[model samples]
Target: MSENKNKSGVGMKRSGGMGGGPMGSFAGPIVKAKDFKGTLKRLLGYLKPQRVKFIIVFIFAIMSTIFTIVGPKISGNAITRLVEGMIAKYTAISQNTALLKSGKDAVIPIPSIDFPYIGNIILLLLGLYLISALFGFLQQYIMAGVAQKTVYNLRKEVEDKLSRLPLKFFDARTHGEILSRVTNDVDNISTTLQQSLTQLITSIVTIIGVIIMMLTISPLMTLVVILTLPLYVAITAFVAKHSQKYFAAQQKEIGELNGHVEEMYTGHKIIKAFGREHDSIKKFENINDRLYNAGWKAQFISGIIMPMMRFVSNIGYVVVCVAGGYLATQGRISIGDIQAFIQYSSQFTQPIVQTANIANIIQSTVASAERVFELLDEIEELPDTTNAKLIEFPKGEVKFENVDFSYKSEESLIKNMNIDVKQGHTIAIVGPTGAGKTTLVNLLMRFYEIGAGSITIDGVDIRDIKRGELHNMFGMVLQDTWLFNGTIMENIAYGKKGATEEEVMKAARAAHAHHFIKTLPDGYNTILNEEASNISQGQKQLLTIARAILANPTIMILDEATSSVDSRTEVYIQRAMTELMQNRTSFVIAHRLSTIRDAELILVMNKGSIIEMGNHNELLDKNGFYADLYNSQFTGANLDNEVI
Candidate 1:
């Protein structure tokens, strides 16, 4: 029986598991780069508002590229000039010797040339180089500034969209995956955006300028260089297309790994109690293997790009030398021109290779962009209406009329449920496992919308009210208590910002938690570990109650509030709850029937429908579902328990 029960509990659809669809099960591994062009254009559109800064940066980039192009040209010219001067001197000497040998020794005149032009050319080249360096730095500085700003706003926008999304969105994504997008993926975009644009623009411009210069010097050589470009471009595109899919997959796998590890560590005690260490290890290894394979695949494709490009570049060099040398020997091109063409070919090939190499980063950036935008484009489940207005709670009356709900559309969790609680009334919902108690609470809070019918507060539909204002009217404590890592003061103050220390203590006292807290070394100043794991379960629940009490809401919903405590602690909590719910509308869902005898209405539900409804004794007389549950939960108990 115990084994069957455990199996059933494990099979209970694990809450907060990823939903919607399976991840990374595409027919083909790579998503085409063309598919993302529109997203890239949309991202670039964000720069429109900063057009002035963009233009300034553009101007600097052009200037830098011009200087970069000029550097190779100047150096090529210097080489040609030096070669020409040597040839000229050698030719002069040969002619003078021939004149002397021919016995026409009439003092051979040597060609004298102007020197200022050569000096001016050399000086011009130096000046252009210095200017290029200055503009390069300026361009990089401005672009980096813009990239940081763009990323900052982009992250802020994603965060805002996430905040507006309904709870179901979070239910479908792991916390680590979402965090990676907001932090890791966003950081990748910023880093790549900062450096890639400036480098890409400069390399492209420089490559174009060098090719044009080569064409003017020797069109044949230029054609040869152009022929080699297609092969490099094709290879880069292919590798990038494949690498991007793996890169995106790699990121997703890392997120899954993080989430899996977090779950294992957080629930280590439970796993140990069940002796599931080997099982957990196998599970972890599977996720880790997927991550490792994805990472290696991405890096392998990226690694191939540079070496392949360089090999193609070398082929271009061999072709240029053969073609250019033939032209120079045929007297169709001067030696100086041939040398200059060779220099320009090298210049042209280097940028193409560099661009091909950097394409890896560009692909990764695009992949990150795709992931980020995918999140931004997610259709929020239940967006609040634009015209929704705030409706203040008069007396905290709540009613559900013919309500129906389904967590997933195929199966209903709540079915045609009708419930009403008057102002200042206490209602208890008792049901077998898998009944709709939690679903009812979810609908009440509007975390999800009902499939049919409506929920109202004081006769006004909840949908007609702003969600924020509607939720502000109630305080809730769930079965599993969650506390963030923070000082006790911060956690309690989360209920009401600007709550005084005295008010915090008052609420803590009201929850019957003050005595234990005071015994701690630092009291309110003591820091809690993640999930407050160091604290006892009773203490955690009490702290949760203190938070709700501090909010001072008109309506309170407590689900299994004292389920994890000892009898003494349960009694203490019960007393505190009595005081907290005095003259306030309240709802309780508890397995402990003794906890709700005083409730004005007690509902006994099974499957997805209510089977019984009444006050305590009236239901006991009926000898139905409610009576059976009450007797089973309170039989042979202390005499006080029977009365309670």
Candidate 2:
């Protein structure tokens, strides 16, 4: 069920994966892309269709940031209005002593308050802010839709691509690495677009608008604001460049750490059995320490952007204030204009700070994008044949002629191998560990293509047959049983679509699983947990056997099918397997020679070659390697339960 094609041999060991994972959580890679411009272009292509929405977002962002930019200017005007109004009124009242004396010295009338002017301007400022808030809200809402939909499409493509990928692809990467690419990387793109993209636009617009406003007040003061721009840019670029490498390292280290955690957790029982708890902890800490080093460096470098910019901007601010005061004294600009210019000068540095921060975020997004694009760019499985035939339940004759294969092509594992089997004849493939037992099946099932050779079913080449048709002709029960979180009945009948309740029960009975099912509280309706942890190993194996039995294929392949169960359970499974093997060609891969002593044709394999091929008794009479292996079980030469 897991599609573990080459589950043994070199593929089982650790293969370093591609990117960041859970430990770094939302913190994406810090590395610069090999082609930043190209990646950015491709990333934007997803949003290209939402041009209208983006345009609206831009307009709204400009409106919002501009309003924010204008707020301090408006406040400056209010202050000037209050100050000058009070002065003019006082002067007028002092010159009108005659009117004050006529009324009464104690009854000095306060100048009529400019209630209408103040009220109208306050309302106008409120109206501007209300409109700005509306645009800002609309911008974010529409952008969220576009961002989420883009990633939704991306995730779909990744999922679809996974199904078409070759076994070698999965073989080369850990599941955690693939998971990080689709989920963590895609999420990074979404977060950056929705939050950082809009912020970037707003920051840029604010910078430009603040510049224009300052120039209008006085170009001399605008120079003061502009003088600090280069310093801000230099600081951001320097820190960002240094931080980028750490982010990349952080992503890689986190991915490795996560893969280790996933591996260790899944194999915790094995570790404990071997008394390797201390070793496992030490291994985890090594990975964690590398991740910590990278993470700290990345944050520390990027962290320099804000405070440094603030320090430089503060100096510019002081310069502007002193210059503005001089110009105001010379009467070249109104106090109000000088005040507005001061606000603009202060506002200028904020966007610089924001842009610098967003630059750091963009680097991360690009890192995520690079990994995402890399996965999408991987070579998929070879396309199915154009004129493929659909062989339905071909007579179980299978042949392998002049076969050759190697994981790395230079070191040939299988060379010029040949095998021929008659219909309904039991073929038991025996081999030592790493003897390419699973790999042989993998090639037969087209999980991996042979380097040189042809495999056939009933005189027709397997390649000529459609993959789906070929798969339907064979039923495989590997040592490792896989089941989904579903009812016991559902898991058993999985391969047989829309199977009747009676039919499912019959298959379960055939696999010797019905007795256990009936004993359970839920009978056939018993639910399985995600890992199928609720049932014993024997029970899970029985369920898989039942599932395979329901398929009713022309041939059967059992790989260490009874290895996990006790001797008593093994007897029951053997009976079920014998019953299932009746009238069907069976390929039983086993290490227990005793179980396969009755096999019609025993193929003794060593290092990917068949050293001997004959019936059990015939091999024993020959007293060859097969005889030695069979004799070793009784002689105690092979201490393990499995045959040598």
Candidate 3:
């Protein structure tokens, strides 16, 4: 994995894999023939579970093809019988007239064929039609069910993969793009499989049936029909190849467009505050333009396919009509035979057109499949290790041993860092904006890996411990708190699934959030919107703290937990924090040095290196980085309110 070399900050870590060169460095987007084969193999693998339904539907399709062929033939037979009967009746009248004019009683021999035979053939044609229609419905229903079920399973698998993947994956990619894959791309696959696969199957079957019936009627005529096949194949193949590329490009642009839309909505407040609505519109237009052009190209190519196929089919029909007429005129074949040959030839070309339509669908589907496979193939960070086991962190002793880390190989964010927290101790980490303070906690949480050294819990390497077992020990309260769109009670209980109502209320009370929650009309049942935007930042943080407290983890990490609250709320929050940290291993990062004056250990960091370390007053007495920072910044920050 390649890391970003040209960035710096405490929270500058990439979200997915380690930074690497361009993902498709050696191979480009054009899928090779072998690649297509591999994709088809995987797609077919999804069908294993639906094999029984597949076999049933396929058998019905074959029966439907037979009925389709038989129905047209019976129609031709009915027409032939009606025509022959009319001709025979007319000849008899002519002969009778000639005999009577010669002064003799004309005796015309009447053909003994039953006229109702034509009606029976017509009835038989209707029966065949009914059969075809029934099977068509069966095939459609079964195929649609298979497609939907396949898509459901596929989406679930991708969602699970996303959850298991490291946070870094989300950092590099836009949420909209990922959403596009799961929703839009998967929908495309469903449409293609349900609709196109059915048509393709029927077309292939029709092609075979037509050839067999045509050859049985006239080999020469069948050969003439076969001659037109190459033209349809050439046109469809050319259009399919071109259309696939454009379709793939179009889908890619759609993902990009979706990404932009999601970003715009997510940052709408920022854009409006800065009066950048026009700028957002222009940016959206740029992506919309790309999507439009790609769509236009794909549609243009796909449109040409049907017209071109119909033209070739028309030419084949003409050839069969002219040749069949000539054969009938010369008495080389019966009128019924000639008629059947023409009908068969026409029927044969229908599949060619059907095949062309299926080609368009397959092209579009392949594009979506490619995008979905790309995400599934992504490398996950922090793969589970063999022999990893859960650890018993009864005391929550955290120790950092000569830890070093960087967002990229070319930049080092933390150098030879070391820290340790005893059971039930509070350690304060104070630093400038880019001094790797947050990066330290990120490593300890195993959000990112250390370039050198290790983080240990209860004297065991965290990397050697199961991720869930290790993370279950700590509860984090971030400065920017996030609450889902749910009731207050539900949000608090989210930290501990299946938590009782009483437990949630007690945690809320402990965090000093119960009073405000009680004032709301819905109280603990009040539903929040996205990110809890309806509530004040302080309330949100307190709710989050309540959630963390409800989890009852052995270790607690507070990142500027009280920064958003007012001075009046800050004291209450401080008291809550003190109570929460008591008898629990705690790490605090604060801009206000006064908040950490009673901390058991204080580490002052500068440029990824710890410049001073001791208890709060001991470092202040030393008059080093800690003293300079406190006197210049935090000391003057709260003096007016006497917050210290």
Candidate 4:
């Protein structure tokens, strides 16, 4: 099953896994960056190339906000003009009425409202608003491009870094954890840059512009509005401080839930076979319950922010209204100015709230940037030697002299191991689990650098050769087959670049996979799903063998290739192996002793050293470790436990 599919077969998607709600970014848990200043500086470095676009964005954002900020005041002026006109007309009417009552011949002309002036003001306001919208759109468009490009470069660097990193790096981390950094963390940065960054600039500009406009109208009213700032900050801080832990808990629970879903979905077959579905469901319910508790608490706490802000804002509004009304009555402020002041007061609180929310979002974004940077900063594999050697035609002769290696520096696994493999010789290695059977092949392939030794191929040190060229010398078909989501023909042809249809079919026939290919509905064109579960295990193994056969390298590695198949399938695979190994140096690691009876050399390994080396008949005559191990297969003795 796809990891994206939840237990109920529903698709589950997360944005940064921060447990944010419908309120968008405002409801997420805040994640503080460990090195805020440093990480922020580094993140800004990615924007340096797009500094021109960002500068334009800044200018456009400020211009858009300024036009909007001045609108309320201008509209207020129009209101004052209308009010003054009405008063003048009323006064004129009263005078005319007095004259008529006193029987006077003359009468005052009643003043008409200046509709043209009001019309002009309305038109000016419309123009300003339209210009503001245009600027806003341009800035957003430019910013989106900049954000995408910056993230593109960052993602690319991370991908390139992964290729350079040693295998141990991957071995030490879970696939999901690494994937989260690549997918989720990178996506978070992209979202912040695209949306929050522009909003942040506009918000700050709005707050400053609103304040300036309010002060111009009435400093007293401005002061009243300003007094409410501390309350907003206090409420925001209080809620954020208390909600931080719950948000953190929520994020943790989300990760656990995702991990559990992924693990169960991938191994669902095993769980069902073992009849653990009930236990799985119970465990899932337990995780879901914890997630619910953490999620609601985080949301409820963060959710109160806007309501609390509104409450404080209303208090400020009332005080400003009272103050503005008094100023207007004293003729210290115009009625229009008072109205604009109220609008400014209302506008003031919004940007402050947005700014606070953006601050939290920026913190989370920086934390995500830190994770991606960490991956980029991981120690990579040692660079190949300068002027690396390349063999045009490899002879398959291999020698391991005084090889010493270990996964960890504190404990040694292979110590001063030595071996010589002639061209076209078959070497069969038999050992218990953790007995260094696979480690020997790993050293030969230079998967890990030997602590102290020299491994040479055809008299050239493998280290001296280019890593790519060295890898090209061998073809490996492991017990665990790996086939991607592609046509079977494509999978088989993966071993040889630009392989033709005929070449692929020839390799498949040699591996005895052609018969199965013909039986499938689409034949060689049949597509394998992501896990390749559509085909049987034995069939998957045969496809891998076909791929290896297509490569036709000088050396072959058959690592327990037939270990997982049934007896009947094993016979078919063994026949394919015989043909593949006819004229090539091959290393076969097997648990079953009977499979390697025809091998030129059979090495019995224990702990980290070769305990005995000989042909099957010679080892059996000697009746030593190899003899005991070989005899135990038929005798039904637990040789692995007893011998180790």
Candidate 5:
């Protein structure tokens, strides 16, 4: 029942892992990888198939950065030509003025500025920027395809891994936690690969290219710019180290808050019935407060990175300007060279900042990758035998011989159990809450492997039959009905593939569900929501019963199948089940002893062992555990809470 509640949206929110915050903020909480190098190497393996595309991306990225980097140097040269041309004109005019003032009857010719040369430089600069932009577009376009394909393959593998995993694996984790890995974590990896990885490549290329250009203009100014690298590294490392815990806390709090809300929403009726709205609100507020503290502190600390980098950058600018002015005055560097070196310096710092930002993003991405890998690494169900057998025509005769089973190695449950049921027998199993009633059915269906001995159908070991073939021999209607978002006809037809409309309607009539289904506005076409909560609980059970009837399996397992319906509806369901179970094997787990009195054989189980086995009247005559249980049900006692 708790598992059913969880499935109804208890812990199913997709918390987008980490580093999701305000826009334009370079800093996000970093999630460090447990095995950073190993995870990264594995993540890169996904890209190996796209190696050619990646090489093209790298080449385009470098080409684009190189073109942009050379622009500043070329513009600087234009500045030098303009400055020299202006000076030459000024000197010529001064000499002519002096000669005219001296009355020498001679006038020197003044030179004109070289506007054509400067125009050509402007056109050249425009061409360089245009080419750079084109290359950048291509790089991004190629990288996007590579990233999407890689993520697609990854998602496919995770889905396949999930199918192969055993039921116990899902039993141990919350739906939300597993969903986070599949959706949010995988999305995180996708975002990084598509955006951050390309940005990392370009930033590194820009940094290297800008440094070479700056060196060509002035090594002294390049050295001054390089000196700020240590400060940038120190500031980023300090803030990242200090803010790491807060970001982790922020992520944890977000998950808790989402979980609380999901729980409250799904169980809102129960909470209101119990008058615990105040308690729920208090818990929500407490989680919200912790989230607020962690969020702001993380944002504030990581937010310090950009401004500190900018401040350090400004200081570098001031030193470079002063040094460049002196060098220009000494005729060691031209005016245009000074201008280009300043541009190169600014370009250099920007990529460094971007590289640092991408570093944080990559860390979070690798952490997401590690989580996905962990899911992929989980132990899967044991494979079927190589020479598996099939039951061409099943008789539904089942026997459990010297069987032993336990969920845990240290504890024994259902030890040395044995049962024999001929075809067409209705076997009713009654027990306390934890008496392994459901476990017995699960083992019979091969939902779990037995620890010892064997379970066979028609003299053949169940393990020898392929699981799919074995499952086709039985039908089940559990107490907690599962219905996906679909029309009534579709839901019913899910039991038997290629079932026609006439067949579905026939099954619905047998389960006594057709009358109510016809009353709905859309009748058989009415769509169920995700939770299938649009209909009453009894109606949902009827639909599941209709589905099972359509299957017409050789064996049936009913686990409290009629527990959710009202007495009237339960009578209809009981009639339907009786007809369905006629001349076929059936195992019914029931708490209401009245329902199973007509069963061919009754098995009274306590502490995982069958204490009594006989017909209803024989058990009553014996006056043993089965008789006591039957009498207690009439005395209005809760059998689930009874110890004996």
Candidate 6:
């Protein structure tokens, strides 16, 4: 399965691996990142460009919070004024005379209720809120831009990294594992940056500002807030520490589940053919149950933080309320300041509640950030030398000079292999599976560099040639054909950049594909489904051949190109291959010896050595490994003759 399915463009590598495993690794509880702080610091480095914008946002956030903080104090003053005015009015009416304005130092006995004063104060309060709202809106708007731009760049970086990653990376991991990093992990970072980042900043500022406001109002009341602080810290720390593991476990299970689903969906035909639907369902149930256990545990654990914080906060609120009322009676604090201080204390706990909630979010974000960074830190393919020359025109004179290689150091697969092919010569490589045929192809193509010596093209070391120019010299038709979900014409045209319709038709005719293609519902305009499953395997192979033919390269690689076709169709394909290989160097890797019997040079390989080399008759007379392989195809006839 491929991590990313071939869309129109981008991320086009084929993925490898089966899904699921025993109860270990992913099944184990989630562990912390090895360098949590480093991962977070690196994650923030992506947003470094938005530093100035964030600063502005921070300033606006503080303005909004400060405005909100003072609103309660103003409200308290308005209430106090109302009480004093009502008392003075009652006193004046009892004296049976018009209320008089007293001296500057004396109290003003109210003649009428001070409605205008209260209204003015109310308007002032509204004005402060309006300013807060304006700044708050600006803060969110700026952060939104900052968050989006940051993730956009991060996505681009990951895409570029995927393109540079070595094949070995894909070989070791599943499509699900890679896809999880791209989709789930990147998305987690995106969500945290966009939603939680601004909220976190605001929460911290609000907590600090509220603390200062409460202290300024009354030191005695501040002590009450201080008393309840330890309980809040203890509850938050304990719950957060325990919930972190479950959140990490949840992410891992989700990846496993995704991997299993992608595997099952792509291989449903094979599963049904084998009548393993029940077994597949059972496997799915196992994964799904694990996910449920991990997910709910994470959710349940994080779920307790808010309620627990609210419980702790409520207890503090009750204590402050009692303390404030008593202080008001003792005249140590005015009723207005007492009211303001209580409101300050209430707002203070909210940010604490928010911070606690954000801590759980941060736990998940860190787990995901670590996954994303791992992909970013993957070892890239060695870069080409700065002065690597471009292959202006390839002559197709290829040589493997004492080349040695292995997928691992302990196990040598190919050793001291040497072969030479002149320009325009046809070289047929015949071997069984795992005989290093594909490995040899990969070396020649520079997909895997030789461990010793060199593979050269036209006397130029391939490593010294730029990879893009090297690839352009050859056309390939592999055993497994790849066709995107597009019209048949588009798939055929993919081999050559901007190929004309006439050229596509001509190539198709040469490959004997034009006849069947014309018989289809819409001819070349027919759209292939994903996986090209709507067409037969032979038809897909024919399309791939047509694509390679359209390229008109100086070198060709055909890896079992006709294996899927019937004998009748194979004849046409062989003829097409003969014509395509004319005056061009071609490397044909085939298991069927009969197809390549007429080749100019046959390199018969077993294990990784060319044990026999000759034309058909020459190899047959040798009676070596090559002859035995060719003769084994007719064992039934031999058995019949012996019995007679």
> Largest lDDT belongs to which candidate?
5
> Candidate 1 overall Cα lDDT vs. reference?
0.77
lDDT of 5 by residue, 113-200 (tens): 8999999999999999999999999999999999999999999999999988877898888776788789878998898889888888
Against the unseen true structure, what C-alpha lDDT does each candidate score?
0.77, 0.79, 0.77, 0.86, 0.86, 0.79
Error of 6 at 147 (Å): 3.1
* Candidate 1 per-residue C-alpha lDDT over 390-471 given as tens digits, one digit per residue, 9 for 90 to 100: 6644588899999988888998778888988898899999887888887788888888888999999988888887788888
Give residue 97's lDDT in candidate 5 (0 to 100).
79
Error of 4 at 474 (Å): 1.7
Error of 1 at 386 (Å): 7.7
If scored against the real structure, what TM-score would every candidate get? 0.80, 0.84, 0.80, 0.93, 0.93, 0.85
Off by over 4 Å in 5: 1-26, 104-106, 636-644
Residue 273 lDDT (model 2): 100
Q: How many pairs of residues collide in model 6?
A: 0
Model 6: per-residue lDDT, tens digit, 471-571?
89989999999999999999999999999999999999999999999999999999999889999999999999999999999899999999999999999
Q: How many residue pairs clash in each candidate at the backbone level? A: 0, 3, 8, 0, 0, 0
Residue-level lDDT of model 4, residues 16-81, one tens digit each, is 524465334555655667999999999999999999999999999999989999999999999999
lDDT, candidate 2, equals 0.79
Best-to-worst lDDT order? 5, 4, 2, 6, 3, 1
**Model 4 poorest 10 in a row by lDDT:** 4-13
- Candidate 6 weakest ten by summed lDDT: 8-17
